[model samples]
Target: MEREESNNNNKQHFSHKHILTRLQLDEVEEITCNACECDVEEEQFYGCTDCKYFLHEECAEAPRSIEHRSHPSHPLTLHAAATYSNQSFICDACGYVGYGFCYSCAHCSFDLHLFCSTLPHTIPKEEEHPHEIQLVCEQEKLLTSDMISICSFCDAMNTECWIYYCETCNFGFHLNCMISKVVEEEEEEEEE
Candidate 1:
């Protein structure tokens, strides 16, 4: 476990056969993290520049397994990437295709992206929705409509992912949409 602060050239990560060196990107290219299979969004990450193998810092630190609320019957094990014959998986939480680090239950075929696995069970009521929103996962159906429904927050349709929903308000949005935005307050009142 090499600390990011050290900037040592021989960081030992379990994912790769070669030693990863710390790197900072001044101008990022079309690089993707081998671990998460997502575009390299971080300016600083560990990489084997020679192999073009990279990992987002968070991905490098992910636990090997976790007890997730979504799949309560069994603990999900983390894999560096999809191990299915197809080498791909549809994230149960986001309803999107993924080819990177994922938490899965092999018996149930349930899969979740490393990022999606961390979403809170509930996002408290907000002024925009006026009611508490709870994360829902089950048979693929949106409660808002019998037919496909567009996300209230994002213009996309419910594409078979878990959602933050408010049945009373008949409101729902994808986990990606809810998380991509700044949903938390940023300021506090200052009394002089």
Candidate 2:
């Protein structure tokens, strides 16, 4: 292999010593991120274009370690990709089977998606609701196993996901439905 270097700040200092260039992928069908093992769609990602080694920009810059609030028992370590035989892990925060860019607690075998692990504690009332809403990812503490959670924002019921809530007034939103703070009408506007 030939040694190469670059002066780009965003793609600098990676665990692997490879020359990665920032790219805006076009209408790609099935390009996958080597780090996270997820599909690399038409978005800004970092990779060696010639080698076909790709990484989501978020995955490329994910912190090596984090002190996440949801799992205070131990600090989670960022893994470039799952090392399991099945090549995936169930996300503890959202209860979804995820591939790529997982934060794992080796001691407990608990894992989380990079996006789910970083949800903010509270959304201000000014964003989209009357009262401040808090994200609730540790669902076992608040919800009964038999009951399903419903997103007040979209009226979608889900058994495996986190919710954002305003404790004062009981407003709720699923992380998936409101992660971008996008409402249904906004989606409709884009289709017009």
Candidate 3:
């Protein structure tokens, strides 16, 4: 009886291990890298686990999506990178390369970063300016060329993307730049 119980315990443990490995694999999907254009198996970043869907970790964690949050009274959606006609924009999130993923108020020209749009009214920064950044309008201050100016957000200069103004200061950022910060944080934590 003792031997049987030990054997059964081992079997159950093995089963559990197998299930865990499968779960990890399930979180991964086949995707082509935008940079290398090579096929690679990438893990899903942020998405619905129940659906038969997954995005590349980069795609999933994209600071902006087609969905809109309730803070704004308008709906925002994602657009292909090529669709943008304006210039001098940046993602206020990861500082990546895009004017694609953005949150916009359909009723107005109010645009925000996928990440910045979701930030609370105040943020605690360890560096740079002391005061927390808040959202403000830059439409009037924006030069016709400003529309094409390189946004401090998303870090990429010359790309057309959603723009946001800091209420605390006249600072501007792109959506992707903000998302870059999140990615950097995650990477640093992993290194530790």
Q: Which candidate should be chosen as best, given TM-score against the real structure?
A: 1
User: What TM-score does structure 3 among the candidates reach?
Assistant: 0.34
What's the ranking of the predictions by lDDT, best on top?
Answer: 1, 2, 3
| lDDT (10s digit) by residue, model 2, range 7-47 | 35346535456777776666634578876555776456777
TM-scores for all candidates?
0.73, 0.70, 0.34
Best-to-worst order by TM-score is 1, 2, 3
* Top candidate, metric lDDT: 1
- Taken over the whole model, the C-alpha lDDT of each candidate is 0.75, 0.71, 0.40
Among all windows of 10 consecutive residues in model 3, the one with the lowest summed lDDT is 1-10
Q: Could you tell me the C-alpha RMSD of candidate 2 in Å?
A: 5.3
CA-RMSD of model 1: 7.1
Candidate 2 residue-wise lDDT at 21? 79
Off by over 4 Å in 2: 1-17, 24-45, 144-150, 153-160, 177-190
In the predicted model 2, the residue pairs found to clash are 36-100
